[model samples]
Target: MITAQTFKRGSRPRPFLMGILNVTPDSFSDGGKWDSPKTALAHALDLIEQGADIIDIGGESTRPGATPVSREEELSRLLPVLKELIPSIDVPVSVDTMKADVAEACVALGASIINDVSGLGDPDMAMTAADCGVPLVLMSSYGDPSTFRTQTIPGDGVLYAREKLAGLTEKALEAGVREEMIILDPGIGFGTSPGQATEMLAHSSDFSLGRYPVLIGPSRKRFLSHAFPGKDPDAATAEACEIAASSGADILRVHDVGRAAERF
Candidate 1:
């Protein structure tokens, strides 16, 4: 029973798996297949059966070069599914968004966590999470959603991730988010080259800013292709999960919860 309230900064006694459910038709992987609420709910249930500790629902695709959607469009796609699915699932639900409004709405609808990939790019996002009293999963990304793929590399991957995440943690705390409720993530493939992504993953244990728990999402990412070349995405993702787990990641967001959980 891993719930949003259960995870303290570094208090996770076991690795937790967050199953990803993309409700967008343009997601880089497994898009269109679960765009509808009915299908998305089914997939979420399946992930739970597969040992997922939480369900992360995303309406817009944030893949490299992905077309950005309007706030209204993102809400339209997410609210219906969330409204229908939250009550049915036993585990906590997390909304993946960079918008404060969306995060607020999802929290009102019973979502337990806000998984912001843009590192709280929206100034109001931090307030929304704090007001909701839910955990905020902040990823390390210095670019906006549109240009995240083309951001300039600062320096060494691990150091860059640490600095960026440390900055974001300050922003979150300044916005009134409690220190223990903040979780840090080194955005694995969000704005990093394949080599950089690998470097970040290898050093995920160091992403923590003081007491913040570290989360890593390297599931089926394009960066894995650099290592596996032509290996199966599932196998590669499982390997990535194992590495992340061993490197001190408290949580892992992945497409295959069963396989990822097994690595722990």
Candidate 2:
């Protein structure tokens, strides 16, 4: 089993359950539910009790047509909650961001992992990750949220994700980020069509699991909305977790930690 030492945080791995904590008010799902620090921290504690191995906090909404939040606003929403929860939560905290400054600040505030949806597209991201001595969870996506919704690409999503991740891996290596500190994510629903997302779900083995542990973040994604019409997004998320676990994904980034834990 891959452990934190296998990646950036020097963390030990045991079927990591990454709980999603979206601080934005416009996230595709459960956006406004936990916008406050008190509510967010309570939810985080509940996730830990329900078996979340990691807490992934995000301030910006990356959903389709989502507007970007300013760096100051993003940090304002994130740092207070992080400062309050970092000492209270037992699991490692992963700050979900693409901005170098935001990531550096979060790491400085005790975040153990950097979950970059851009796959370190920012030139300074890798350097900051290396400097912070934290593990980086790099997700493979072709474009930002707005562009992702409009773009289309061919081939299996897993294959494309693998190719993109391979390039990013090389870049991170060149930037002095240790290979063991990097984790690969297929970026479900980020830039893929529903068909491609399903293909990746069915064939996640195409990713380079030997080189880096695979992280599958399919919780309440738009692809799931299309795949399981008339089903609850939470149930669909649980289903995705089962599929991911069986498909060799080492970690599952999800919103419903309790349900996913039961499935696991």
- TM-scores, all candidates, are 0.93, 0.93
| Best model number under TM-score | 1
Report lDDT (CA) for all predictions.
0.84, 0.83
Clashing pairs in 2: 3-13, 4-11, 4-12, 7-181, 8-135, 8-181, 9-135
Q: What's the lDDT of the predicted structure labeled candidate 2?
A: 0.83
Residue-wise C-alpha lDDT for candidate 2, range 200-225, written one tens digit per residue: 77665566555687888888887888
Clashing pairs in 1: none
lDDT of 1: 0.84
Best lDDT among the predictions, by candidate number: 1
lDDT of model 2, residue 185 = 88
Q: Where is model 1 more than 4 Å wrong at Cα?
A: 1-5, 8-14, 145-152
Candidate 1 per-residue lDDT over residues 46-110, each given as its tens digit: 99999898899999898877888889999999999998898899989999998999889988998
